[model samples]
Target: MNDLQWYRLYSDSEPIVEKELLNKLLSNGALAKFALVRHNGEYKAMLYVNGKRINGPALPEPLTTPNGEVTHWMGNKPGVGLTTSEAEMIIQAVTDRIERAR
Candidate 1:
């Protein structure tokens, strides 16, 4: 068993948004395949990609449903995150490598 790398994501959106973000990250090699795990109402999405565990970012805002209904309660502090440009840089680098490899 290997320890997963932890990434903290902050957003004022629904879990589905977080999930979508995770999916994007996975497709971009920022993450691998993952599992959605919940404990005490806290959702922890984990994945092992390239011998690294990429833990999905946590949601900071309350999660709402597609109908705009609140589904889950987010914590008071959603915390800060790396700039989008920084994340995109990583994504692009990985995507480039993947493209070249393919």
Candidate 2:
């Protein structure tokens, strides 16, 4: 997947907040800045540049909760919402969902 492409979204309405989110995620190497354009009224999720979405929002389960959130795998700690086996299942689910949605 070395040839992987990236996707990103930004809106002036959320400058401060979006910038903070981008900074935090970037530090962890999950994504990077690719393009910045005006999309004032468009709500878009960053889709796969190759037209494929990642296997999961795979968002951390606890983070998916109210306001508590954490990203990244710490030493031996895996983030919420996925275990080794669960990740495989999520991978399948994500692919299935995206395929149907598209």
Candidate 3:
């Protein structure tokens, strides 16, 4: 089963951990305002704004990796990514989570 737990987003120098807040941000303006960070092979959030860090709220876990990140991997397949339909489903799942939180 492909199970998606939750998404923790980063925006330039902002950290958005709440699904409701993400929707609020999107509702307030365009999607360009947020810059999401990718993890493993998925999108997560981390912010860097004008050389400053903004903590929007408390998240289930720290935004930074607790034990640091790996420098090398064998199956990364740099050029490979999800198919159009796969990506669309994930986006829809994320959107559903945000809507459910509202």
Candidate 4:
């Protein structure tokens, strides 16, 4: 994958967020080290993992019930640029979270 090419997590049906993956990510201790920022009234997260920048919209604080769903879609596109290692880490993290959630 291109280092500058943005990519979003997806399941067999829809995007990973549609499966409430954000909740799983939020609850993961490995993800807690990132910094959350509010940009233009929206929350975004920035983390340097595996020597690459991992960034994307953040789940709203004081998460809501039934999923705490918060998706960032700009013009029908939802993703962020990441390096190969960063992308692998994200995928691994999500996979681990999914397995734990099962």
Candidate 5:
């Protein structure tokens, strides 16, 4: 799928950082960003957006109830986060979305 379509799919299903906070991060050009990654066969919502070897805070993971309710966990831990390619894709997708929305 294309970037926008892929973004819509992922955004709908996967857990991401809070929109407001993410927007702030992007606006500030923060090197670290937030993302959900699959690790050891389980999904991990990382605390920060990591590129290369840089590290940052850990945010709570996203959880969905059986009834489709969504909530965040209250913990932060370091883990292998998104790959460089994945981060680039996410950035491009977000940027494309913002531009299209304008």
Candidate 6:
């Protein structure tokens, strides 16, 4: 799918650039900033945007997106997106678990 919407959370940190962990945090909403990352003397495009919370804390992973694809260049790679499917899934899972418990 088109990943909910545009995206959120941008960063060039090793954790973000080294691993593509957006999907994990996408469920858990967040507020962050990102910039061009220089790793191993090489520049990768864009990595990923963390997200608002909708599930348990995301586990650590070696995540990072390669090549910062630019659809609209506003200078200095930065973007945002909103994915829906994953959010919905988290919501359902949480609700079901709660109802079953009650």
Full-model lDDT for every candidate = 0.34, 0.28, 0.30, 0.33, 0.40, 0.31
Q: Model 4: per-residue lDDT, tens digit, 1-102? A: 554433322222222222212212332333323333333333334343332334444422222222223322201112223333443444455445546556
lDDT of 1 by residue, 1-102 (tens): 233322223221223212322322332444333333332334443333543443445322223332233233222222123234434543454345445545
- What value of lDDT does candidate 5 attain over all alpha carbons? 0.40
**Candidate 4 regions off by >4 Å?**
1-79
Q: Residue by residue across 1-102, what tens digits does model 2's lDDT show?
A: 233322233324431111111111333444322111123333222212222232223222322333222322211121222233433333444445446556
Q: Write the per-residue lDDT of candidate 6 for residues 1-102, one digit (tens) a residue.
A: 344432322222232343232242222464432223233333332333443212212211111442333122111223333234433343344345445546
TM-score per model over all chains: 0.26, 0.24, 0.25, 0.26, 0.26, 0.24
Q: Quick one: best lDDT, which candidate?
A: 5
lDDT of 3 by residue, 42-65 (tens): 334323233233333211122222
Q: Is candidate 5 or candidate 6 better by lDDT?
A: 5
Clashing pairs in 2: none
- Which has the better TM-score: candidate 1, or candidate 6? 1
Which tens-of-lDDT digit does each residue in 27-67 have in candidate 5? Answer: 24544444544323333334453343223323343334322
Clashes of each: 0, 0, 8, 0, 3, 30
Compute the lDDT of residue 32 as modeled in candidate 5.
48
TM-score of 5: 0.26
